[model samples]
Target: MIRPSSLIFAAALGALAGCATTSAPRSGAAVAPYRDSIDLAGRIAINYSRDGKRESLSGKFTWRQSKANTDVSLISPTGQTVAVINVTPSSATLKQSGKEARTAPDLDSLTTQTLGWTLPVSGLRDWLQGYATAVDGKRFVATPANDSVVTRDGWKLDYVSWQDDAAAVPQPKRIDVTRIALGQQVDEMAIRIVIDPVAQ
Candidate 1:
């Protein structure tokens, strides 16, 4: 049987997949890395651990974003779909394998209710662009290079490496994220994304 955490992880993966943007930076000019939106397809490996228990899932993902709507799909290693998540300004829905569709007022609430954990869905778009989304009462810090460590909202994101696509702006290749609570580490996740070369 698939573990609940695995389902949650898959849903979270789906949520992240929804943040990809389709727009590319112009050539031969410096441009801001973050775009208003994006669409992307790639592979993702998620590792989740809490209090010595750990779960890992690796699969393919697709994310499309337009204005306030985002759609994400997570596929298992065996080429079967695991989950699909749809997010909008007011609601989020998750459709899992062999399960009834679940909905909540937002992605965070939906994941918390169905997956028993909350993912940073609101900030993922910014995180995907190598930046942090601002939250009230939260402090965000970034490296001077803007390509390294980013800490915010009790999460520490390490930009391990970047992918250089010819004729396109380089994008993040590997990222490691850790969740902290009360000054102690509680959970961690890693994501490696390969932007579809043909999509650019």
Candidate 2:
């Protein structure tokens, strides 16, 4: 059975268009090193399957920067509107239906539990800049962009694929994620992300 936390992690897999990254921290590894300025405005489609339930979510989203502060909306299967979200670095305000917007901490767990997904950020920021996260124990490299896999705490990971260009998203030709499970019960999870530079 697929867990919800896993879904939260899934949000971290999409590729960004028109994004930018900053130089490595002056000293020591930075918390949010992957900094890219991408304009995510277009018809974005995402497909995810968990526990045998297939979910198809398609809509228009625009992220001027790192998705830190932007307007996001989710379209329901029945052509109904579910929610509208406004996020910022310090906090997040959400408006559902005709209700008022609720302001909460930036790190709200409600998203992962209620939506079966996490706020999409961070990981992609790092990934877009060609950085990798570590995967501990007996792991293999699936797709190496810079011959460097992000090694965090000893986990071996590689973007199964991703855009090989320096261009910010919308035209992300390649986007994939692979995780090697060492001491965990789950062995692996594969995620694919696509960006449409020109969407009508």
Candidates' C-alpha lDDT: 0.63, 0.41
| Per-residue C-alpha lDDT of model 2 across residues 50-118, encoded as one tens digit per residue | 576665444443445554454445444344445555556665555565555555554344354345455
TM-score leader:
1
The true-versus-predicted C-alpha distance at residue 32 of model 1, in Å, is: 3.5
Off by over 4 Å in 2: 1-36, 42-60, 66-83, 99-102, 112-122, 128-171, 178-180, 183-191, 198-200
Error of 2 at 35 (Å): 5.0
Q: Estimate each model's TM-score.
A: 0.75, 0.48
The deviation in Å at residue 127 for candidate 2 is 3.2
Model 1 accuracy (lDDT, Cα)? 0.63
- Rate residue 187 of model 1 by lDDT: 58
lDDT of 1 by residue, 1-200 (tens): 55676576666765563333334433443324566667777777777765677777788878777677878888777888788888887888888778888888877788778766777554666566656533333323233244443344666566666565232455665666666566666655544554453353
